[model samples]
Target: MSRRQRLMTLTRMLPSLLRILRRFRPYLRPQAPLLAGALLALLLSTAARLLEPWPLKLVIDRVVVATPSGGVSGIALIDALDPTTLLTLAAIALVGVIAVRGIASYFSTVGFALAGHRVLTEVRNDLYRHLQGLSLSFHDRAKTGELTLRIIGDIGMLKEVTVTAILPLLASSLVLVGMIAVMLWLNWQLALAALLPLPLLWLTTLHFGRRIQAVSREQRRREGAMAAKAAESMAAIRDIQALSLEKGFAESFCCEGNRDLREGVKAKRLAANLERTVDVLIGVASALVLWLGARLVLTGALTPGDLIVFLAYLKTAFRPVRELAKYTARLAKASAAGERVVDLLDEESDVQDRPDARPAPAFAGAVRFEQVTFAHTPGKPVLDRIDLALKPGERVAIVGPSGAGKSTLLSLLLRLHDPTEGRVLLDGVDIRTYRLASLRAQMSVVLSDSLLFAASIRDNIGYGAAGSDTGAEPGADEAAIIRAARLANAHDFIEALPNGYDTLVGERGVTLSSGQRQRIAIARAALRPSPILILDEPTTGLDRHNAQAVIQALEKLAQGRTVLMVTHDLDLAARADRILYLEAGRIREEGCHAELLAREGAYTALVRGRSGPPSPALSPAITRPIGADYAFGP
Candidate 1:
């Protein structure tokens, strides 16, 4: 099996709590000192609890009953005092014990909470980084909402469980152990009677705990599915509204939401049942211990003060059991969330740099694909064995039918995915030998559908320079940005806007028209100082005026760069120095436009198919003059 497969199998094999602790141990290590302090405080609080009942016992034995002969050893001063002063001292001691326990408990809780927050914050950061590093294939198969839930919702839940449930359970267990030891030492018979309901408590806990966890896990799963649905619907709200699909999507989302609600109710019901069952068991144990202790006190075998202290310890001992039942459901839910996070972390990316990979040097932009082949699925090659090369400063266009692997060629050259066989070389070095970041820094791309962030136009354009190896601070060179925007014919409209370059664009650039968005994207790409320029259907949807402006921008952007254009616009392809006609993953024809048309093959048919009723203004004969301020010029 592969490493990812083995990890997945192991994730399923291990218990949830154990898996989470073991897998996330690295995050826990840094918080060790804080966690240790929290644990120490908890122990001190447990010790305070053990001493809590003694002051009451002292009042009963020494002051109320007037037992004169017996006094606590090593405290003769207290025994030397009169009954009224002794009563006052006992009362003060009771408050002091309660106060000490309260103070320790507060510190312990705060410490645990601080540690949990720090550790979970690191976990969330690592989870997000891992998700970003994962290959496109993993993302193509994953849900955005579910991944978002793991980062925000799941990690937040883990924090809550760690502080509120896990720490308290650990402290309660210590109290249970300490109280039980004292009860046994005080009176063995009464202690044994106090332990009778424990076996039944154990069985009840086991039964109800499993059911609650199962219900909680299912509820969490449904919640994730619901979130995924909501996110998907929101992301495509425009398309859904245009197509009138809102009702159907809403109904589907509500169905998942309702199912999640039902599971949540079921989990709560199970937890409630468990708590009540535990209460009954605790009541029976308390009654048995009280009955036996009272008889012992009356028969002179046990003192009245001793019986009172014994009962107090007995009550405290069962507190852990009651708490265990109370927090069992929350722990189970967090465990389910932890499993989800671990499963995501286990997914190994199909694409990553080799250990010996080095940063890519600056490129002259000569590219070659030698016997290259690739497939998203085995035996279904998207690009077959094909040899191709481009000289430095050459402009090459690729045209083919849908699914002809034209775009796949661009993807391979960009190193988005490695070839299934053979190699792709840039300036005679295999692209795989270069670091991904540095290799990608040598190229700039403009796509058909431009996407923009919800930021100012200046910031969006600044991203291009950020990706380059310019070594300049991002957005620091506003003069260069304005120059690029001018080259793309985008400066006039941008300045006409209410806020000019600093105007905020809506998500995905929905606030702007298509031509304006495209011009801005061109400006962004033009800002990059890369030797290779990639244009994929850059003018596909533009109107005549915008298309003419974009073509003029492209003419400037193409100067002195190795330009690779993928388009169905025969008019654009005809302008390239050479054209490669691809069909079914293989290069069918390659030559200058006139030479390809002379061959009377796929290239001729493609051109004829698109050129039947073309406008004269968009004709192949029309050409644009290049500007002095070149996009890729040094």
Candidate 2:
């Protein structure tokens, strides 16, 4: 690589590396004491390594040169001492230096390993918490498998690199600096020559490191994509088998795996080439230094022992350079992994609570929307200028076609997404002013596809306890659970199961029938003491017999709560105290079934288009004129 190109690459990488380190400050600060001890041990070890060669140099120069009468000795002190005694001291000093180096090296490795593992563990945990706090919009756009790899796989790579590459590089750099200082003290001219190969090593590292990092990043992304594909296929295994798509999915997954393999091989090849180039440069530097040192020895500018010591320091000094080349690829991969972790940590949640928000008080269940406008994408409003109100203990059923914003209206009320304009109010106060958890605790929901965790049936029901606001632990008592189950008409089937309430429902309750799962979900919602209830197509995907049972249970559950139900069943809509007919993101009609039908407006056309006339459950009220009777009032 050209010097300018190497400099530019280094310039780009240094800031990112520094940013990654800055992000780790909080995690690193806690382990400062361990790191400090490690630094001390490293210094002691470096000092020992620097002292190690001196004893041999002294023996070869002083004791070997001394005659029986200490003839021709340069130092008077050495001349006064016997050569035999001096040689013995030198051997003892060498053993002591080696012993200290070994002991210090052990402590330093343990300390750095302990610190690195602990820091990475903290990073992993904090990353998970941040992911959970992110808004649903983010999760909607993100893949589960990629996020999973960042939490587990990327952080693991960082830990491995820290242990295998980072600590050793740190120790070797210290040794390199110490060796250079000694070399300069011995002879400054030779010291300059020893360092000539370093600039070449730097350029080589810059060229290869960037390529390795890029490949590693691509490999990680491919791995995450493969994981996502596998997770997607497994989650839809039933459909995959029914459609016979297993072979197709396997082929796609293999394709991604092969791409990752190619990247891995390419990274290793670059690393190997860089290491071999570094070896050649070091050999050249050594040959030049040996020739110069031998000339100095012969010209009486240096002794034979001095020349030997210089060559020894030269090899030791360059060893760190060789080590850096060998580990450059690993370090680059780790750098890429660390950047991924840092990016995740830096992601700010879109819907976190405001700092000034307060816990919500007990709700009386009055809800209103004031000119609320929302769109998942701008300029395409889903619920446009919706101005509506619901009284305490009233039941409102929203009926609309697909994509008519029926679900979006309910989502706005629940604060799943903030309105682009205006506000959603609960009991006359803006709901955004309330803490998210507390506000959500004031209502209970049963979705169309009721999801059950892989746990005992009792535990799944107990998730509703958060809405109860009882300040008690999760998981209701047996009596309460049975009561809620009975209210939802789920107790009989649950009792029929071998494990009763303790039965493991399996993931998403896949083992249970649609009706059974719906009933359990209803039981969970019923267990909550919240005064506001939201139901979305509760009878969807169920047989008529099961739907009737569910409707009966729902009637009992909605006895005194303010209920908002979104459904397409006109039979059910006709029975509501109030009905809203939404279309094209606006409420086209709003009144009781009889009032809207009497007008022969949009609501009337909708009723006429159903498979048949409204059911007899509507009673005498269906014949009333628009103003003849009250739909709902206390």
TM-score for predicted model 2 compared with the true structure:
0.90
Candidates in order, TM-scores: namely 0.92, 0.90
How do the residues 1-634 of candidate 1 rate in per-residue lDDT, one tens digit apiece?
A: 3446545544553566687789889988888999899888899899999999988887887877755433542487977887789889888988898999999999999999998899889889999999988877788888999889989999999999988888888888899889889888988888889998998897777777777878888988888888788889888999999999989998898888888888988888989999999999899888987888889877877777888988788777888789889997898899899999999888888878889999998899999999999999999999999899999999999988878898878888888888999999999999999888888888989988879889999988888888778855556699999999998899999999999999999998999988888888889989988899988888777776777778778888778999988887667777788899989999999998889988998787766555244423334432542112112222
Q: List runs of model 1 lying over 4 Å from the truth.
A: 1-14, 67-75, 470-474, 610-634
- TM value for model 1: 0.92
The sequence of per-residue lDDT tens digits that candidate 2 reaches over residues 241-269 is: 99999899999999999998999899899
Winning model by TM-score: 1
**Global lDDT scores for all candidate models:** 0.84, 0.84
* Model 2 lDDT, residue 526, Cα: 88
